[model samples]
Target: MIDFGFTLSKSSTVDLNKIDHSRYDQLVKLVPTARMCMNCGSCGATCTVSEYKGMSVRKVLYGIQRGEDVKAMLSSCMLCGKCTMVCPRGINTRNLILNLCKLYD
Candidate 1:
């Protein structure tokens, strides 16, 4: 058997039905604005931490929905409120981030 230069990468598929969503549901209840996000890059673009640390509010929100641990990512957030100012949906992103952090505590 001949080996190819590279083998197939591990599956990146996420089985939404199998992943736990209780945490995300709780977040939405605490911060209703969590549901208003449209995954627009605006929040990430305006994030101060994102400029150097690659911290993205959009990814963090998605991570919560996927049941992935995002505490470390959330820690990088400076709560500067730039994301809140730029959100087209008018979501209070600072409040949402605060609430998301509280969900773990």
Candidate 2:
């Protein structure tokens, strides 16, 4: 019999002032439609991956805006274009995810 009592807890504090704004600025410049996101949750609701996993396009974008590490979430995107089709704000969700992936790469 093996008893496992080990648990890993992840915790970190983000300093907004310390985050490099230039990277985000460059990203926005590359994907101008990203700035139009209204955070309306439409993208998240329409996401196929989000239904299986907790990944949401809106959340990932917000994390990027806050300079948070969202590589894992960003990688989960399928680029199926469902989110973009449902976007009321007309944000290019697929392209945004691709750009984020490139940024992290």
Per-candidate TM-score against the hidden true structure:
0.84, 0.79
Candidate 2, residue 99: lDDT: 82
For model 1, the superposed segments whose C-alpha errors exceed 4 Å read: 1-10
**Per-residue lDDT of model 1, residues 1-105, tens digit only:** 589788889876898787889988998888888888899889998889886667777888888888877888788988999998999998888888888878786
lDDT of 1: 0.85
Given candidate 1, what's the lDDT at residue 40? 88
Clashes of 2: 0
- Kindly list the per-residue Cα lDDT of model 2 for residues 3-102, writing each as its tens digit: 5887656764667786766656877998898888879998888788886666777888778777778888787888889998999988888888888788
User: Following a full C-alpha superposition, what root-mean-square deviation does model 1 have from the true structure?
Assistant: 2.9
Against the reference, the lDDT scores of all candidates come to: 0.85, 0.81
